[model samples]
Target: MPSRSAAGVDRRTFLRYTSAIGVTTAITTGLTACGGPASNGDGAKGSGGSGAGTIEAGLSYALSTGFDPMITSGATPYAANMHIFEGLVDLDPATLVARPTLATEMPKKINATTYRATLRKGATFHDGSAVTAEDVVFSFERVLDPKNASLMAQFVPFIDTVKAVDTGTVEFKLKSPFALFPSRISVVRIVPKKIVEKDVKGFDAEPVGSGPYKFVSAVREDKIVMTKHDKYNGPHPAKAQKMVWRLMSDPSARVSALKSGRVQAIEDVPYIDVKGITGENKVESVQSFGLLFLMFNCKDERFEDKRVRQALHYALDTEKIIETALLGNAAPATGYVPATHPDYRKASTVYSHDLAKAKKLLAEAGAKDLSFTLMLTDTGWVKDVAPLIKESWAAIGVDATLDIAKSAAQYAKVDKGDFHALAAPGDPSVFGNDVDLLMRWFYYGFWPEKRYGWAGSAAYKKTKSLLDQAAGLTDEAKRKELWGQVTDLVADEAALYPVLHRKLPTGWTTDALTGFKPLPTTGLSFIDVGRA
Candidate 1:
């Protein structure tokens, strides 16, 4: 699931490593030459018939991970999971509004700390098993089990126990009053107990769910195939009977595929090509909460002092980078929440570019003559932003050496405390849009406790407490007020702060497909899309 930062682009690593191994040529030879557009595992021609609708699209990312909604983190597979698996309630692909999917309607509140949901009648998994209350209970239990290490568990800390009330009804008992309980049910997707209980690892590779589409076959960095679940009786029925996601990691290749009539839509459209692609193809840059985050190894002596972290944020020319490096396709990260979010609130401690303030803070922290290695991911946009960060720090009398590498490789160093700081793209928007969920993604759980080395600190403990208090509060205004307090403290400390929120650019032939809107998250979604 995206809860684990899956399929989020480590764009440069995917492109570079694939190119080095002749992956581009391999993809071309494997897919293009097999009959026509999409190829099945047996190298057989796809059922791209006229009446039975089919949509072929290019994705900027490769299948670098699994498709399990509980643990999958790669952007490509995360997107695919949306089509194959569904929760009781789901965030609409475009609007982020909570909508009922597996359940007949929103989970009704039985009490302040309990909720009840009745599964939709006749709903069945792709394997043809009935969608029973036992299945729902099993799904939630799997996530709540600490031994499984399911990333989805972090998002639903309010859930104390999920029990089967009847054959079709399920009840959830919460530890406290959670305002977003109804919508938060979307975090734990319902999976068949029989299938998963037998072969958990095999299910991750070839998933079987009760979603609109059924997984067919997947070849990493090549293609992912799916067919419409004819038995699907959901609100958003599959408009296209089949979907072929061609893994085009190269930006130009995705655009070229759209132009050459090979694909009807493409994701991660290059900023440079937004205006250049004309005629039937159109590009739209959807504003997203996806951000380039700046995090420090808080365990390190130099960054242990919050002032050092603040100094780094103050030194960056954020506005200039957004305008120049991002081609004005991003907004300055003024707060934890982006300007586009409905619940947007500007933090009290907004960091503006000020060299004097940065130097002063460094001096106060006893590190005026500072020098450290800045570890960065090699995503295309991150590469563009890296030099600007270096220049900004250098101007303030700080020597920052750039150590650019793949996200996983860089994280290996970060986890082991071998690096000073990190800059990379991340989007927790997939899990939720609320301030609490967003804050928890970085500050709470495994990320801070294990990876960033901030859990033991006083600041982290206070942050966690504030979040817990906010969760228990039934009043909406009070909850937001507490969130604002958290936003202020985190910003003031500047441990893991955002540099900017980027716009996700996507291109589609408007005339060729219907209901194919651009997404604000990492990967593309075609929930109710069909050929025109």
Candidate 2:
């Protein structure tokens, strides 16, 4: 396996690749808890558990990225960062609905273009610094700075400026009236200004936030150690004394750890093993908005025509792939957004599995014998589904070879415009749930502009204008109407579209862990959850 520089990949690409690294570990590690609070400068050590107060979880992701809320991109780091940091308004771990965390409540809409947030008075960072309006302003400013190249900035283009109105009040003036402004605040988390100002790089390496847990250390491909932040005074306090997230990327290792009592909970449980795990160990497959999407290199002359893209989608037997490869843990994508979402709308051009239509379309497009490399991530589920896809394409006279690698390496090729088509799993629901934010993630920003090569097209420009116009409108029904139009255009274009929306399977000990719920998003959350 070759290594690639992770310099330019976006958050979605970063996390997708992060979850794909399945490094196998033979032994489970125990957390060594700190007796008392540790300063932010000196790293805190985690404590061990006896399946009582302290909790251990086997995560299927490795920490390939940093921990800065503004920039951290990998799956594990993002999950851990959720416990270590918080935003003015944070999404509920189980249900991705935006709620208050650092703020007393969700940001209040003062006017059409302005919103106000009041910080909780007693909240403090892991470093023991007060969470103030200045810190909130600094957090947003750092992300908004172009020189920093923060991945979060793209999601918050509505903010014109963030100013401290008082000690506890922070005001946001938007570039325009963004209807999604309240929920969108979750995108940029609040950070302590002094710690980050001292050394931004150090803060990225050892993040200090006001969440339930404080970061202790992160050993790549091994384990990330965290202890309860004793000083944290907030709504969601740490329920367990310590949490040791063992990075057992291999599926068998995770199940083994869970069964052997080395871990109380485990994420990304294999579909095959779900029925086998019994008694004290409980397994569940919760429906999620996460998906495996097919994106084409529109710049490639072979895929320049819309007909070829649609032909490729039609060629795949999605229903069969869902049943066989996913073991009935997923639903075939009916539209741009999944049906589980609140704003789900069926697209006008839905691709049902049709091999005959695919062959006809291929012949019409003058591509009777087409051959292309289908790039994919090394995620356990994705590898299982990759062959099924190849076989489906083969049935339609398409020679599709697999280019399987860690997500970072595969995306390196995608980023450089060196790949023809890609099929990979992604979870953008972590950032937001609205149709506009979800659509804009791939179609509006750097993704379309750089990676997919569709920004220059007239269709792409029209989609952008429609999204912009919709964002300004205060009417909810009219906004969705415009969003439906964008979905129709993208689905018909087929440059990038979903194959299926999957159910995230997570297994945990019913007796050992309490209040632990499976999340619809990629990462795990332990807020308000405890060990039995």
Q: Candidate 2 on 1-532: residue-level lDDT in tens?
A: 1111122354446554334432122112332322334332211222323212667888877766677777666678788888989899988988888899999988899999999999998999887778999999999998888766677878898899999999999999999999989998898888899987886656767778889898776677888878788888888888777777888878899999999888888988889998999999998888887888898999988898888999989988998998898899998889988888888889999999898898888888898678989998877788899999999899998999999987767777877789999888777777777788788877887778888889889999999999999999999999989999998999999998888999988998888777899888776788877776
Over the stretch 209-258, how does candidate 1's per-residue lDDT look in tens digits?
A: 88988887777778888877877888877767678889998888998899
Worst 10 residues of 1 by lDDT: 26-35
What are the lDDT figures for the candidates, one per model? 0.80, 0.81
Question: Where does model 2 exceed 4 Å of error?
Answer: 1-52
Model 1 lDDT, residue 195, Cα? 85
Steric overlap count per candidate: 7, 5
lDDT of candidate 1 at residue 259, scale 0 to 100: 93
**Candidate 1 runs further than 4 Å off:** 1-52
324 Cα displacement, candidate 1 (Å): 2.1
